[model samples]
Target: MECARKDRDLEAEQALWQRWQARRDAQTRAELFDFYAAWSRVLAGHYHARYPHPLAEYADFVGLASMGLLQAIDGFNPALGSRFKSYAEPFIKGAVLKGLACYIKDHQQTSRERLLSVAGEAEEGDDLATIVNLTVGLAFGYFLELGILDAELYDNDPASLYERENGLETLAYLVEQLTEGERRVITGHYYQQLSFVQLSEMMGVSKARVSQLHGQGLQKLRRLYEQVS
Candidate 1:
């Protein structure tokens, strides 16, 4: 009985594919997607479970997987004698990874912008200190993000994958030198993409205090760099 049900489901799927190929209409395309949508969700859930990102919600992954499923339905050649599930799995997984890569890139950009904002808020007559803090903050932020970076989290672009091999080591050393409060602020903001407000709430402090810690962290990193150089 189980085998019979499986055969029936397969036949229905094949019929839908044929109808889609014949008319190439939106209705048929959507029907095909509906048939495979559950499988796409399964793939999305699988990948999300395997590589959870702090910045990405599970729904984000599901949406990306849906896009991949649509592509698979549009491009699949049934005559090739391959199962649709097998063909679509790679497409779905690829989409999820690609989406994650974009998310990480956006987070990194936000981190830079926040660093710049913090630098701009520095008190007058601290021009030199602000510049140094901004430079070190940006550098360390990038490295911290890179340290947790995965190749699969990168778009399949080779240039995007290019990273300094020593970045992780440098980031670790600098981070180690930070005071406990500074470490919490810097790591929470850069590594987890937390906002100053979020870090403040987590640490039970004022947002201003969190920002101050972040700036002090960057200054310490700069001083450490100067000492090493």
Candidate 2:
């Protein structure tokens, strides 16, 4: 029964991809974004937390992520045999990062042009609850990637306070501070609840390698986790 259900879901997703690829029509493209757009928010929230803009709202991150989603829709190629999410994740993330980098640069340049000085203000506290699983990998420079099952690429502290809570209702967030390979192993082992041997097989690498990542990921999680959390 489960296998049949999985098959049906796959078929539905494939059909959606086919529709988008067929004509690249705007309406079809819109439909695609409607389905996968939440991932943009999930992925972008991580960026917002990492790169806080004193004046920017959470919605600003969503807008950037939305742009990435649109870009992914345009760049996704169905012929690759990978799931649409697999192909789109990187493009979506890349676009968001590029947008964020531009935002930071513009802000920095504008600040440089300003001759006026303002007093330093105390940082504000976050009220929203954030549910996330953080593991810093490849981007941090010390994890193993077996070329398969990679979920990312790589979050912060008081904001870390909100992240300590547990519940599906909290609206999980995504961050890519780690490399794509490292994120995959951590997600597979921890979030997916896979065993080291299982993850090793899935990733086409030795179990020892998986073990190393699990340890390193845990250390990073501790280092990056909220101190009071």
Candidate 3:
């Protein structure tokens, strides 16, 4: 009779533990996302330090790390007796490497074409409309090739504090700091998340021309960021 009573108590304890474990798991998952949200900039800094690129673009790495963090949370096994960081470090590193591979693949193919175009047209006057059109088309085509639907790209607009704070005032300040076209392209592209194709079409320019404008805009923004720092 005593053994039976003890068995019942143990079962109750086990059930309570199971419930607590589930709750803890959920809390941990949320914490993991928050951790990644904070760590993304740090991860990007590590990447930038290791690799040379025209810009310190970190969006792709952030996206990849978020995926890794999600995977780590889902696959975490307390029973396995492995540390979370041990499992996650490799996963996050792999994600960053994959992002870098994609960046390299895109660059190798496009760089030569862009260089040739620039060399051929170095003396030619700017054709703003043509440039914008070409950029929009190319951006659209690249996104399509990557199986990213137009609807998916355009569907979401995540709110940020920066965006919330008087966009025009921010833009005016950016313009004061950046050149005319630099301000326009940055405003049109990154802030608004408009694809190159969309900007090109709206501006009545070719896709290639829009790329040049975007590149120039990025350069000016980079300089402005440096100056402020």
Candidate 4:
């Protein structure tokens, strides 16, 4: 009974969105923004917490997220068996990274060069900034070269015989080997889509410590990923 009711509710929401998308008027777009701006805030906050680029503007990310949310709402088909957050978050996150290069190019030449240069270095034995730089550079329609973030992007068929070979499947297993704090840091940061500031508050740790734990968690996932691969 509960499941059926939930399905009905989802369908109703989908129908409403479809109507809004069809209208394509300024008022409808404003309504859409009002509905989804909170999601934009969550995604922007999440990336901001993780990537505190000193020379880059954070508002660029926030604006991109709102734009992404609008795109997601306009393009989404709720019948596709994907949640709005799952479908929209990627769009939001991608826009932020791509926009970063443009923002950096105008604001800081040295930092832009530094960010681009980090792409070739291996994830291990590198600073968290390197991983972050790689993430932003490669996240737009390209595969992430590192562990957790890369693994998160590969969508595999559930029943496929080669599912075990999926990087995300492999990373999921590696996550089980992590310590509780590490698991919390990675899962909370990636899966829950929480900001480091929010995660820090939740865990009663400093924001710096949240970043440290995130880096540490990635290190462990990297080692385990190597062993399995």
Candidate 5:
């Protein structure tokens, strides 16, 4: 019942948006504002929590994010056959970040290159960022040539499976098939750059147990890859 009600609300909202889009209605602007205002605040909070500038307030971030949300709404076309939420969320968040960047540029007198360098360093070891682009996911993308992951995987398109290899999504799905200990062992070893000894220490298990987990994970990954291929 709740799901049906939510769906009805969404249909109504989209219908209203379509009308606003046609006539450029002022009330439609207000409706968009009311709908996304709280979301803007939440996204702004994420920036505020991690941003380097101490003087940057939550309200300021919210204002910046809200502009991004508005831009998304203005540019959106229903004919694209894409979900508005999916397309708009990234656009809004990107706008907020860009706005913050501009503010930083004006206030700090710092170069954009320096800010990018610092941000890069902060996200260097994060797994989600590491595996973000499928192109990079194959050969470990950006981490390639650094000996972080095997180089052969880079030979294929990370986005599409031309060679019938397991790719990133398949690997993740396979990991879901693993026992928790096995998953941790593999993630720590490859993704987190932890040695077997380190994993053993962290998990409060023997080195042999860690080795067993690693073996299990590898086996599962191999099977999954073979099945996909």
Candidate 6:
């Protein structure tokens, strides 16, 4: 009886995937998302439990995991003969890690900015020197924190290193396939952490243009990812 029930559930899920893939049915996709919502949250909770960030709440991880879950749903290939959960786990984890990385980076940048602001406002002589020293100490601390976090996130095992290298190579290949404008926007925004406003100023284009390029670039990347997957 239990086996029969499980089979029925699997059949229902397979039907949903077929409808979404064939027709890009919005309702089917939404249903799939709702069905897997709890699973996404469980994955998020697992990561949060392992690596709790002071600045990031559990809800934040859940939100990031949802983005990953959506990507998984969109990119998943039923023809690949792999279970959806198996394929989606990596995407979901990657999204959470990427979000955590961005959060830490932003926090570090903010700390540096605050330090610089303090140094700029400090009185000349001993006060200025003290502020500079404090800034240096804080910067060093942030650097160490990043190093430790990275080490914790990525294991030193051979399999892990190989997987990381392969993932980077795949990403590089995908980036290379982008148009010049899209390439610039994607690289500058992601790698350089430049905002659309900053990219606009640097590229001598309007912010709207930068945003459009960014959207186009991401769309292309998504298609490329699906192809490769």
Local distance difference test, each candidate: 0.69, 0.51, 0.49, 0.60, 0.57, 0.67
lDDT of 4 by residue, 1-229 (tens): 9999989866766666777657655445444555565567767878888876665544456655756676677677766778887888888888777766565435243233223433434546888877775665434212222343322334556755355356567666777778877776666555443456655655667866766676666556655656776
Candidates ranked, most accurate by lDDT first: 1, 6, 4, 5, 2, 3
Error in Å for residue 208 of model 4: 44
Error of 4 at 141 (Å): 37
Top lDDT model = 1
lDDT of 3 by residue, 1-229 (tens): 9999989856754554345357755433433444343454455457656764553255445545555555665666656767656777677677667756765424543434433332333335758875664454445333322331111232335554334343434334644666655454444444333445544544456767767775665445434544653
Off by over 4 Å in 1: 104-229
Off by over 4 Å in 5: 104-229
Task: Write down the TM-score for model 5.
Answer: 0.42
Candidate 2, residues 1-229: lDDT per residue as tens digits? 9999989977877888888777666556655665665566677678778877765545556656666666677777889766777777777667656766666423442122111111112135522221112112222221221211223222345454343333111212222444545555555443332445555554567766766665555445444433323
Measured against the true structure, the TM-scores of the candidates, in listed sequence, are 0.45, 0.41, 0.34, 0.39, 0.42, 0.45
Candidate 1 local Cα displacement, residue 209, angstroms? 49
RMSD of 3: 17.4
lDDT value, residue 11 of candidate 2: 84
lDDT string, candidate 6, 51-146, tens digits: 788878665677678778877988988988999999999999998898898774244543433344323334556666687665654453233223
What count of clashes does model 6 give? Answer: 0
Model 6, residue 36: C-alpha shift (Å): 1.2
Colliding residue pairs in candidate 4: none
Question: Could you report the Cα RMSD, in angstroms, for every candidate shown?
Answer: 16.6, 18.5, 17.4, 13.6, 17.5, 18.4
Clashing pairs in 1: none
